[model samples]
Target: MKKLRNNTALLMMTLPGLLLLIAFHYLPIGGILIAFKDFSYSGGTFLKNFENSPWVGLKNFEFFINTPDAYIITRNTILYNLVFIVLGTAVAVALAIALKELRNQRSAKVYQTFILLPYFLSWIAVSYLFFGFLSADKGLINNLIMEPLGFHPIEWYSVKAYWPYILIFANLWKYAGYNCIVYLATITGIDPDYYEAASLDGATKWQQIRHITIPSISTVITLLVLLGIGRMFFADFGLFYQVPLNSGAVFEVTNVIDTYVFRALMNSGDIGMSAAASTFQAFVGFILVLLSNFIVRKIDKEKAIF
Candidate 1:
């Protein structure tokens, strides 16, 4: 009782945050029931509507699975995330190492700020920026590069073939710098004694980086990769939806699970189906996190997130 009294102020400070978490995250979990029901409005209170809805079991889930485009969306979601994780991690780590090698702190700070600026911009803003470069008639790319090179201007939005590379590059530009910051923090925390000892032993800079820097941060790299694997089934809705201007021509390549669900919800007003899709995503993500953690435990017990 005396111990509780001693920490009363600190506990009071945490009360609001705890309440917010419970209200937003834990409280809404009961609404997962709507996914299993034929939810419909009956001109009543929201809770009354849910209560009146008939239970439909797995029908909603089956509808999503049996759709013709199901395979395409699932494949795109997983593949894009895999590419993002692999390429993003490599680029972020390389950038972090390069930043560490910079002798001038001011120049390094400026470069870091410039790289991180993209991450703060909304996807809506980025879509307009991309439009300025890829517009068919007046785009900078066609007017400046294609015209000067004696080539015809190509229609960017109408072409499906180029979207895969375009989406990947845009994803990297926005997110790579944020990931680099995490790696840079890990790199900064390394003890100086290891590098000093390596230098004394006549190790080249590349050798030191390969043997010392990489090894030192291997655990952090593994943790981040595992966390990424948990969300492999999810995609950034805005990136796939807004960046391509919702062009039907590019839907074959850019349509992901999230975008597909959004389109379905908008076109059909099927709340039950939308709920099922979200539940499916959440369930798959949970399983992936567990499976990935189990694999990590088998390989290295200490590195397992659990």
Candidate 2:
């Protein structure tokens, strides 16, 4: 009671966020029941309809588990996320280190601002920016580079082979700057005495970074990676849906579980099936976080988030 009284203002400051969390996250948890039911709006409030819905057991899960897309969407989601995690971390860390090494502080800040600007742009805007360069007929790539080189104008959207790379590049372009800023903050927080000590020992720049900087920030890196693994099942809906313009031909490559569930809901209006998919995603993500944390704890107890 004494400790609580001392931190009363701090506790009060957290009230709004705590209430929001309960309202948005905890209260809706009861709606997971809809996943197991043949949900229908008969009348009255959503709670009334939810109470009156018929139980359907695993029937709703068939949309994902028993369908042909069961493998493709799952495969795409996992693979894309794996690439994003590995490649994004590498790029972010590298950029952060490079930015930290810059002799000109003003130039570094300017570059950082430009890099992070794309991250603030909506995905809808990004799609149009991509279209400006990728449109088949009069796009800059087609008109200037392809035509000038005597090659045919490539139809970017119709081609599935190019999309994986395109999406990867787009994801990096949008997110790497924001993540770089995160890592830069971590790097900046590290004590300068470690670098000074390493320098006194005749360490090269690379050696100092390897032995001091990376080791110092390994906890932050692990935490971020673990948090990312927790969302492996959830793809960025706007990136997959808007970027490709929902081209049917490229669905084979871009169709993640999120987009697949969205399309299914749009075409069939099967709310129960959509709910089931979301529930499955959440459950799998939860299990992955636990499993990943266990592995991390085994390797290095200090690095584990829990």
Candidate 3:
């Protein structure tokens, strides 16, 4: 009776949020079936009137597989995400360790706040800020620095070659501090007695970090990596789209599945096809998550997300 009362109370408190989630997230899942059907606005909400709309099961998937750009977009998505996962984690881990060494807690928190500020800024805003530095015509980079050094002011937008480095740098700047805070939290949770013992053994700071900090946080790092790997098929839409500003020349390096889907939806206005693309992304992400967690379980069962 006590457990049932507690459960009922919990349900009462959670009902509103549950309804909101259903309205926003789970309720929309029905649209995923549109990918398999010839969904039409004229056909009403459930997409009736198939005789007019028509069904093309597996055709969209086939279309994507046969397209030459499939390999390219797939490659770009995987490569960019892989790099972000590896480098982002490493850099964040390092910063977290370094910050933990600071004696003044308030000063450390202030520095953390400053570092995390950029993450709250929109990517579109970042794009314009970057324009001031890289814009070919009147950029400060050209007038003040590159020109002073007698180098030509390269047209950054028109050039596809530079986007790889540009994307990596942008990602690092925006996410490194945010990610570091997670590792920092894990680091702070460690028992101080371990560190005290290491110090008593005359361990240097670097040695202590290498021997203690990294090893202690390895489980958290592994869990994070597994979570990241699950979303390997996904890409940040703004980071890929707004950052490049739809430059046709740079599409080779910047185009990913999400951007391609956006372009198709905007141009074709084909709800079914767009749904198919989105469903594809969700499916890939789902499978990757399971696969990654399985691998984690194999290596270290305790660290697996499941």
Candidate 4:
């Protein structure tokens, strides 16, 4: 009875968060049914919208799957995310190790602050910044480098070939510092005794990091990679949309699932199709997470998220 009474206060403290989760997350789950129905906003009560909508079953999914651009969007989404996961993890881990090795605490903090600043900037702001550099007329690259080297200014916005590299670089610049903080924390928690023992055995700094530091953080790296895989189907809408300035010329390389859905919604005003696309993304993400966790469990039961 005493323990139950003591736990009652903690339960009461959690009630608000529980209510919020139900209201925001679980409540919208039923709306997923809208994907199956041909949803339309009728001029009537809110419930009437669903009631009057026609049931199209799997037609919406079939339509999306059969679309000509479906393969392109899916390929772009998966490939870009794969590149992001691999490059992001490598760069973040390297940055974390470098920061860990920095002997001057003040300089380390300054470097961290500068690197992390880009993560906080809005994508719209970054787009304009890119404009200053990539603009064909009076741009930094054209005026400072190209013109000086007797080369004509390239039309950056119209060129499809350059966007993939630009987008990857922008993603890394914005997110690497944020990701590094996680690895840095893990690195900081590592036992000092391992390094000391390695040093006593005449191991160099590179050898110690290879054997002790990286091994210690391998589980964290695995967990993070799995999480990245889970969301591989989703793309950052702003990064793909705003950064490219919605230029039609670059759509070949810049288009992804999210932007494709947005364009479809804008053109067709079909809420059902939009909902179906979202549901598809969610379902795929859920399956990937489960599959990744299963594989992780087989490899290392202790490190499996489940």
Clashing pairs in 4: none
What do the candidate models score in CA lDDT, each in turn? 0.94, 0.94, 0.87, 0.94
lDDT of 3 by residue, 69-107 (tens): 889899999999999999999999998998999999999
How far off is residue 116 in model 3, in Å? 0.6
Cα distance off (Å), candidate 2, residue 60: 0.8
Model 2 scores worst on lDDT over the 10 consecutive residues at: 40-49
Query: Which has the greatest TM-score?
Result: 2
Which ten residues in a row are the worst by lDDT in model 4?
41-50
Candidate 1 lDDT over residue span 64-97, tens digit each = 9999999999999999999999999999999999
Residues 1-306 of candidate 2: C-alpha lDDT, one tens digit per residue: 999999999999999999999999899898788899999766768878887888999999875688899999999999999999999999999999999999999999999999999999999999999999999997899999999999999999999999999999999999999999889999999999988988998999999889988898899899999999999999999899999999999999999999999999899888999999999999999999999999999999999999
Q: How many Å off is the CA of 260 in candidate 1? A: 0.5
Model 3 bad stretches (over 4 Å): 1-24, 42-52
lDDT of 3: 0.87
Candidates 2 and 3 compared by lDDT, better number: 2
For each candidate in turn, the TM-score is 0.95, 0.96, 0.91, 0.94
Clashes of each: 0, 0, 0, 0
Root-mean-square deviation (CA) per prediction: 1.9, 1.3, 2.4, 2.1
